[model samples]
Target chain A: MNVAVIGLGLIGGSLLQALEAAGHAVTGYDADPATRELAEKDGRNVAGSVAEAAAGAEIVALAVPLPVLPGVIAELAGYDGLITDVTSVKGPVRALGIRRFVGGHPMAGKETSGYAAADPALFDGCAWVLCLEPGETDLDDWLTAAALFTALGARVVPATAAEHDRAVAEISHVPHLLAAALARRLVGNPLAAALGAGSFRDGTRVAGTRAELIAAMCGGNATATREVLTAVIDDLRQRLDELSAADPVEALIPALREAGDARRAWPPKPGAAAEEPAGAEELLALGRAGGWVTAVSESRVTVRTMRPESDRITP
Target chain B: MNVAVIGLGLIGGSLLQALEAAGHAVTGYDADPATRELAEKDGRNVAGSVAEAAAGAEIVALAVPLPVLPGVIAELAGYDGLITDVTSVKGPVRALGIRRFVGGHPMAGKETSGYAAADPALFDGCAWVLCLEPGETDLDDWLTAAALFTALGARVVPATAAEHDRAVAEISHVPHLLAAALARRLVGNPLAAALGAGSFRDGTRVAGTRAELIAAMCGGNATATREVLTAVIDDLRQRLDELSAADPVEALIPALREAGDARRAWPPKPGAAAEEPAGAEELLALGRAGGWVTAVSESRVTVRTMRPESDRITP
Candidate 1:
């Protein structure tokens, strides 16, 4: 496979290294001459410009910042090869309406950025989202792009561009915004800042990410991000209001329980297969919805159960 | 020192073990007979009643639920000993006005609770807030309480009851609500639940904490908690509104930078001395103010400066 990754930043550089390690013939280019020089000095195949990088490649991946991607895509529109991007948001990329272009976003990153932070193992076991619109890329090109990412040790997930945007808004973009906003609350209080512990650190860990990158992501996916944020604000406002109710503690139980259930339902290890509960068969025989018995206290027995097929499927 | 720990729950049980480990004559009691029996079976001094536990003790620590602390304190008020608590909020505890009572809160816990989850190392490297009113505990008692917590491997921080409540509202209580509310947003989204990764998992980790415990904290400190939540909502709304601006990416930079600064300023390893920065002196000399330099990018250097002395000293 002949591959070219343009814009040699963290994602681009790491993708180049991973592709080359997987035995693909790879060329890389960056608009920044310093980045290109660094990659060239590291014995990587460095191209002088976008045209030179895409010249002989069967696939071209634009790994530039989110806001700069559309312009880069436009520059390489003449190329007949399969094109994809490593941007966090997919709606704008899909809206570009470029032929042979399939939007992609690998769910992997660190707090640091740039060419210096790139590593061949960055995409290992990461989820690489592919916006597989039938009209955009032919079946062969789609399969080729998916196969390339899989070979790079990513779990390739296929979804529509809209679905990708919505899911990312809920799980990634909104969480990042929430983290940043929560961290900002501590800015005025030095004592609170000094006394922060595990919860404070873990909750705001993503806020320490490179500012421009996060800013671009939030800006690019503004509508979806804002929609989630609006809903979140309403939910939080209701929670705060409930704190003043006659039975504040009782009123909070349902919301807290739902949050706990949703959190526990999330897979601990990403990309791992959902495991079958131990003793699931016996529990199913005794109850309508059942799985394994997780714990037992003096007053109650706690069992974790999966919903029945009837209950799981909505009307 | 003779110590009595009322309420053999997670915090109480852990305090009992830590005090006993520190060579104090410790006695434990719980309203639940089963908990007392379990502790006694484990070779602990499990007293049958509050009277038995408080008898001949120099320090009596109340580790019960927030609402129950006042009642327990009232019950043992006749005892001529220093009374303290491990509640999350301090204002209400201070208002109890029991003789020799100084509000105390251990800034440590886990999702799991009760004696079964107790460990002597629970207090290690955690911050213990002590509320010292000039008229309450004498100098000797204050020193004694501080020394006991320090010996249990905690960093004893002294603050007024009001300061303690406000700071905890900004740091712990409000963050817990933010986490639970964020997690609650994903309750109905199956894709978001499945796709939740490090950010979602870590950001919402505290939502899995016991509902009753968090409810108690929020309900008990309704004023401070609500104030922080209101301010947080305003900040978040401003951030969300910024995402829709003409230069959304640029607009998000300050918020992201502030978030990063606050997160970085949090003491990395808790209970350790603040380490001097490598180039802080140079930066301080160059600038009008000095603080922790949070992030450095290609174009910007972000620093978090303390408020001016006049501003910090509120009238």
Candidate 2:
């Protein structure tokens, strides 16, 4: 298979490497001649121009930024074979007038940006969003595009453009915004540098992402991302109100326990809470009560609060 | 040095293993004898009761939950050389009132909970917040306690209890709440379930944390957590209103761009604005010039609109 990858930076360049390792002929393109020259030196066929890259290629993989997508599509509209894009969001990308443009979002990235940070295993086992709309033309072409990325170890799942956007709105876009917002609050705060520990680093590690690219993503998906941000913020506000009126150490155990329980039951199970971590709650309640009724859930009353201040408190 | 770890859970168990691996004589206590028995069977530590574990030990580390902390401290208040506790938050644990107690908040943990998931490299290079107040206590004693954990490959940064909590409020607790709220939205949404690709999984990944624990953390750091959450909710609400009313493709880009720029500049160098992205205003100007900017930042702009949007409109 001949694969033509546009935007030979990180994602596109990595695809070129992976395709070559698989013994397929891989050609790449970029607007920057320097990037093209470097990629050529890296042993991939770096096209002199976008059109040259598309010449005689069986699969044209558009790995350009989301904002530049529509234009990239126009350039590829004349291509005769399968066409796909590795844009993080699919809705806007699919809106472009092009057939066989299978929308793809590879759900993996790293703190390290640029072609230098490209890795062959970047998309391994990662779910790749593949969208084909109802009015789309050439289904066989779409399948051919999907097959190429699938062979590269992506779990290619089919969806509509709307589904793809909304999914990312909830997960990718919203989370990225929150990470940015949270990171923004800390960047200049005196405690930021010293206090920015692992959890902070991991939570906003993606902050190292190309600022321009991410900014456009949030804006591009703003319509879909609006509700996600609102819902999250509302929940956060309510929780903040509930928690802040109290002290962290005095009130934290139960919250942490709840978070721990929720985390334990996630992804691995996909459904169902892991046996309600009854022990931690019980120990917490008992510890809170000092051998009496400490707290009660909606369904059950538990005793063990020893402090008079905590006496008669609902569990 | 002989070390006594008072709880045989994830953090404690791993510490016991690490201490022994480093050739330190380690004694362990888990009020639950079963845990102690397992520690023995696994050759992780010498099996002993709480009192037995502390006997003849130069260091006694309390790895128990905070609610039960006071009792544990009271149980071994007099026996100690540089006592420390591995609680996530420092305020309440410091109130445990041990004479030589030094506070530790290890900035590392797994999505998985408990000893079974404990990793030897858990604390490697991670920032371990050491909260020591002007308690009229000896600094060397607390520093001695810090040295033990530091030996295991942690960067120990000294902080007051209040500083530690505030820092965590911005980075740790707030992020956890955001993850939780995002995950909660998925509770009944079947669309989210089906559309949950890698981005969703990554966004809500930590949302799977234990619920009660998170609840407790919120409760514990209630005030600071509330402050951060309020700011987050307010900012998000404004963003929501803007995007809800405009084309996500247009209206949302500027806000996200600015935010994404600020987020990316974390742990900034002096005059970081030289690295600053194009602000929204600049991007707006650029967009007005037919560039069709998707995101605008302080010094950067992501031109999402294709060049032909002009041709399409004019023709």
Question: lDDT of all the models against the reference?
Answer: 0.73, 0.63
**DockQ winner:** 1
User: Lowest-lDDT window of 10 residues in candidate 2 chain A?
Assistant: A269-278
Candidate 2 Cα misplacement greater than 4 A, ranges: A1-160, A189-198, A241-315, B1-5, B8-29, B35-60, B77-83, B96-100, B108-126, B135-154, B184-201, B216-218, B235-315
Q: For candidate 1 chain B, which ten residues in a row score worst on lDDT?
A: B286-295
- Report the error of model 2 at residue A66, Å: 7.0
Every candidate's TM-score, chain A alone: 0.79, 0.70
Clash count of each predicted structure: 0, 69
Docking class of 1: acceptable
lDDT (10s digit) by residue, model 2, range B1-315: 899998878888888887877778998888887777777778766645677788888888888887888888777855756688888778766665667777888777766766666676787766666665664445555546555766787655556677678778887777777766666655534334434544445545555655666666666766667777777777677667766664544555565656556556554332211111233343223222222212122222322222112223332
Candidate 1 residue-wise lDDT, A1-315, digit = tens: 899999889999999999999999999999999999999999999998898899999999999876687677777866898888988888887787877887888889886789999999998877677666644545455556666886676755556677677778878788888888778867656556656777777778888877887887778888888888898899999988787888877877778888777676655332212222222233223122211122222222222223223224345
Any idea what lDDT model 2 has?
A: 0.63
Give Cα distance to truth, residue A85, candidate 1, Å: 1.7
